[model samples]
Target: MTMTFAKRSGLSVLALAVALTGTASTASAERNLFDILFGNRANRQRVAEPPRQQPATTPAPRVAAPKISAPSFHDYRPEAPVKVDFAAIAAALDEEDREGGAAPSPFLEALAGLAGFDLRAEKEVAAALVTHYERNPGFIWVEGAGLNDKADAVLRVLNDASAFGLLEGDYAVNVPLAASAVLDTPEERRQALIRFEMALSARALRYARDAHLGRVDPNKLSGYHDFPKKPLEAAAVLEVLARTKKPAAYLQSLHPQNTLYAALRRELKALRASAEKEIVVDTETFVRPGSSHPEFPKILQIIERDADAAFRAEHGEVLVAHAGSETYAQELVPVVKAAQDLHDLNPDGIIGRRTVGALAGESKQARIDKVLLALERLRWHPSHLGNRRVMINAASFTATYLEDDREKLSMRAVVGKPSNQTSFFHDEIEYVEFNPYWGVPRSILVNEQLPRLRRDPGYLDRAGYEVTDSRGRRVSSASVDWNRYGANIPFSVRQPPGPANALGELKIMFPNKHSIYMHDTPAKELFSRDTRAYSHGCVRLQDPRAMAAAVLGTSVDEIGREIGKGRNARRDAPQKIPVYVGYFTAWPEAGEVTYHADTYGRDDNLKKALAKVEEIRVPGS
Candidate 1:
């Protein structure tokens, strides 16, 4: 991550890039600086390279170039012979190894052996690389005419690592390779170039593994997740790169494939634009119904960073401040919501903590951190979510049914309350329960209903709740001494299926230990509120009929007709649809984005976790 911008005294771009491999960053690609080294306008005095962004999805086929072999110099030695010190090189690598970093001394030793150890074990190894050609007069992988193109492609991928939430620092060999122009001695330079080339190969493999498999395991933390990434083999990765025509694009394709990840990347581009615009506001601070604040101009300026921003597209007026008050006095709730929508917030006109946190309306650094955290969470998802599936964002309190990456239906969703949060997990909807019974969870009884039972046993009786023993035998609530039992209520309760039942008319079932499911809610009014965390962990669907129709492969009328029968019934879904219950605070839908509340505070949890592990270390992923 090029976040460390401190000049390296005598060192230039190459050394700076080399120093960054140990850190993380949110830095953007630098085109102007890159141009001086490898752009089309680069000096042809050195090997010319073209740094261009390539489509990362499917790489175009490459036209193979003729190989250029290095000439042998074994027959006659030079007048001024260069001393090769294998021992000194080994000692230098060992010194770095003891210090504890990314120094793979064993591998470095093997690599040094191939180079004949014409190496300088000095602190200024990057600067010393310029003298590599003066020591030796041959080359390996760095001799072909196609070298410049391959080198340029790798450099472009390194600069654009932010697009995939990976750090540029992880793949920073570009600078050294590009600055190879300064190395005049062909022999030593060829040997040194191979070192950088090998380093790139090592870094690329690590980057690809991280991009494909993700860094952290969600299940390792306190969440419902079963990681599905397969182990990566170095030989397999090398084979792919060997055949890859456009190496940069091929490597780039190894990120989250869903559209949401791409959309977040698009939004990140906007963050860099409004970095200087800070607009901190209270949770209650919002665009007044009748008047707009002077800060309204500032808001417009920040929101206008994206020329095609939804707010700007909807309102193309040149908003200006008044002469005296220096404020724009007009309705701006729509604008606020538009901006919030673009950043994956709840899209409420209210400028709450979640909204401010997303808009970078606080500190620029905070905004950067928030965006970076979002990208990390994206990495924790299934590599390929089913082509046809149901996705419910617990944070957004919304559910979407999609087939072939296109949405068929979407509706407001009521997730769990703060105390009883909906977990992050995924499963297939194998069956549906119509007119379902509400077998209340024990936690709910201990924390919520037990107090009522303690106060008055008549409460359970009046609520029409049926109590039973652990053996499934029906029992009366009045039989137990409320004082005897603490928070552990060793009884089961079920509300009969009907209008008053919490299951409403339907409940979609999936296999999970959390006992969470999707179902219709009698309290439909909860979905209208800006904050919809009103359930006891299970998701309460706003329009269950539509969801049922989509999942069961039928029409809404057919689903309603079945539900209208009044009697209890169960049916298996013809084709089981996978359901993903994810927690994305910032998500992209269509060309815009939606920001939702961090209802469970999971975002904060993830941010802290990312802060600790600077890179990937998922257990057995």
Candidate 2:
């Protein structure tokens, strides 16, 4: 019995390798297993492989090749968005062409079946027809044999998703569309039309969502942040695409729905293009305002690349030399100050860890990874952001109040230190407490108060921290064997409202499982630094009263009057303002993009996750 062989698995294996590594090339005039395993993708050429020699005696028992799974849409696509209303889609399809050319009936009939359907492509096709008609009274996008002008337009956008780090092939645009574009039968044409529209719809929506929200999950990065996964507003995007004459321009608008995202994206692209040599961070040598380093010229070049009119006006074109050597320009004072404030630095116009990191800059790849991760974070938020909300950027260590998209108040905040970094989550600021007591977290009691208690038997008493058993009875720290408990102190610790209380005078409540809240701190001086990750896990607001005024919808004087009463009380807000504790390493505020040191190293962790995810997804030799 003769057994014939199928094509070698080597070619497909090579293809799979290319897809995974995203590089294709030709081998250097040689054939090897490494070349086969790793696609010879150096000069965008594939090396021809030699046939495998048969075994000396028994022809390796005619084995059928192992089945390699073909790539599919589900392989790379994000979570299917929550269902949306295609209610108006049929109406758009029923729409008449005031223009002499009638809308394609086959396409229209295909669309009627899609009413209340979740197929994004049908809606896209319908919207395009309506938009084209609305713009030109007698125009039709899908005409005779194959895809017309609009189909080409849709495919173009679908093809470009790769520029935004998305895979166009995953959309399967090339295969089905090409097959349909050449078919003669009307039935085949109809099927092709539907498939084409659907592919573009899925592709466009995927691109928009990935661009605006991001491709990865923030919670996956650090389990601390509870970022809600919001569905992409794909219908709205389809509408926008249909309405715009410049389809490419409309697609470009799909990135970073917010300012920080746009800023980060631009920086990422620019950094990747930047050719500045990496600087070795000299932790020992501090670059004071007047001090100069051998790398100053290169640093100045980088600054000049992004300096705007305000930055330039504030800093002269040249830095006057000082001490018979190079001096830090006085002009860059505002530059450093702005950078420090935006990055949660001391804002003292000095080069510290935060400042030095910014000055030294990151590897281009590193910044690109950061920007990509930041983009992913944008997707983790709800589909809607209230016109007025509180933004507590845990990364920047600042709380900002926005009314009608305008920044009203921005104050320094002390987030959880590196050991116990702040959690990134969102909730409503429903109420505020004046002269609030500090309900110390168990982690704090275990890691902090317990150690201090061991050192000083009366430390809790001196600090005014009250102890209570889990059963609600008062407990004396002196009675417990501190050595036995160590870090796991079983008792509760509370600091009563007073001048010495850790919670200071007020607390902002947004309840979560973590039992973390924002409150005032007696250590107000800590906010003076650019880096203020001081607390265990809770956030410390630099100015709670100011935040109170913003949240309560009251004047600062009114808050002052309420506090003057000396009554410890909680007040409910007329409307619960939304609060977001987001971690962003590179934030865009004011005018320029300000880079921050990743205090939690969340960026690095996220990069690792991305690689791990890819590895799990792609099969290997």
Candidate 3:
């Protein structure tokens, strides 16, 4: 009853079917063919049809995996045994080992053993071995051994070489046996050692250069390597290493107490002090003749006239005239004499140019320079200053006793002549001599005493001097012919130990190269003057007995007890006291400032030397 479409063929079947299909399609379109057929076929049996089913699902297609490429063996070849000149290499290696080779490596060690060098368990040899292999990589191919084994052996040799200091340089590797033997003379050994050391140092430096990829300046290396001796050569190498590897550490390693640092530190302190604002002079005025009154008519007229006048008529910053009364004159005479004594001028009561210059503050800069020089000198002071101390200010002509920064006492003193200046340094107060003898210095004996002795052979005898033989036995002064004994006197003259001796009452001994010390002088009148330079170079104290007591920490009676024992009584005072003989021309005093003449002219020379030194530049950029 249902219509169905069939597959069409290519030509003829298509034409026949086309005609029949058209007719059948038209008839079926108008009629209910299924109903008609069903009615007619009711009597006939109904044809049965089976139910339809769906087709089965298929899985997706599989993809093939990617392939990996193999490693290339294009240049592969079996490693050949390294062709080592075992004999020559061994000898060279042994020599280097003996001298101390470079950083050790296994190849170097093996090479060393081949040379019969038994450097057992030396770490330097091991380091040398590693270093050798690193530098000479071709040593890796020794046929029968593993790479590490060969390396170990090579390292052993290199380390051994290093232990011998051979790794430092070629000179180490080629040291002659004879050179190692101790020479009869130090000079010979020193020279030989220096030569060998320089060679080793040069090699080490060259290696460093290569490692750093640095420009090897032969001249610079030579300069560094050219040391005075082996120790110096070693030091130079260490210095280079320090500079390159650890600059700060190197600097720290150096002694900070060097002279240069000390000088710099002193200069800094002085500069700091100079920046302070403080008036140098206070309560200073000039006395005029006939002036018990506050002002003199003539001096007041001069100052007032100047104060009134402008440019050209300026005058009277401070009154400057003459001494007023006989009392004033007497006082002024001593002050003037003091000034004269200090400056080596005539001790007349006349205020001349030199004295005027000193009082006018014209020498301030010169005085400051002296203080600076003193500060510089202190840089070389001994490591410690004792708890109790004595400081002699030679320029100011004063001695101050200090116990732990507190002033115990002070005394007027007479210092050296302007020409024979007192030396600056610290010494210990070892002993005190009561009734000390005066053994005159050679300079005084030759220049001053000899002339007097020539004038009269009995001059010394009259002066209470005793001639003595070399053995200290007293001899008669009459035995010597004064005319012939001008400079040829073979004997010595000494003042006997007593209160009347030039070293009066007591002498404080702080032995030094100058053979100078502080002692009581019968010349106490000298200190009353403003300037005292009566001694040749020794310091003469006004109240030396008091000074001795303070220094010894004992009463006067106790000191007497010690002195009575005589025989150069040695007392280790309760404490060791430092006695410093220093020179400072200008220093702060109370509210004002005091200055001293540059009695010795050392300031000028020292200033010039300082200037020259400041201009010098150290080496090594």
Evaluated with TM-score, which candidate comes out highest?
A: 1
Model 2 lDDT tens row, 163-183: 454545534453344443466
Lowest lDDT 10-residue stretch of candidate 2: 65-74
lDDT of 1 by residue, 1-621 (tens): 232444536645554544443322313123333433343311222232222223236433432222222111122111221233445444655565667676452234334433443322112222222233223222312434125566567667777887666666645553344345656554445455556554455556656766766645566556444445555565466556656668787777778787767777777777766645355544444444355554444455555654375455565454323223324344556666777776655665765455555554445555456566667677777657779999998877889999998988888899887766787777889888888888887677766677767666545543567677678766556655554565455678887777777889999988688898999988977876767888878999989988988888889898888888877888899988889888787766655665555677776766655544443322211
Task: Report residue 412 deviation for candidate 3 (angstroms).
Answer: 1.6
The TM-score of candidate 1 is: 0.64
Which runs in model 1 stand beyond 4 Å of their true positions?
1-152, 174-198, 224-235, 242-247, 270-371, 482-490, 615-621
How many clashes in candidate 3? 50
RMSD of each: 27.5, 25.3, 53.7
> What TM-score fits each model?
0.64, 0.63, 0.47
The best candidate by lDDT is 1
Predicted candidate 3 versus true structure: per-residue lDDT over 1-621, tens digit per residue: 123332243334333344444544533423323333342321122232112222124423322222222111122121211222335544555566667756744445444333322212112222333344333422322322322232233233323332211222211222323434455454444333333322232333333322222111111221111111111132343344323434223222221233323443444355445754322222233443322433222323322333333422322222234422222333334444544454444466554344444434433354455555544344334434455788787878889887765567887889877656666556778877776778876666766776666555555554456677668666555444544443445678777665467887788888876788989887777876767876867889888878889878888778777667654455656666788776666543322335566666545544554443332211110
Give the C-alpha miss distance for residue 600 in model 1, angstroms: 3.0
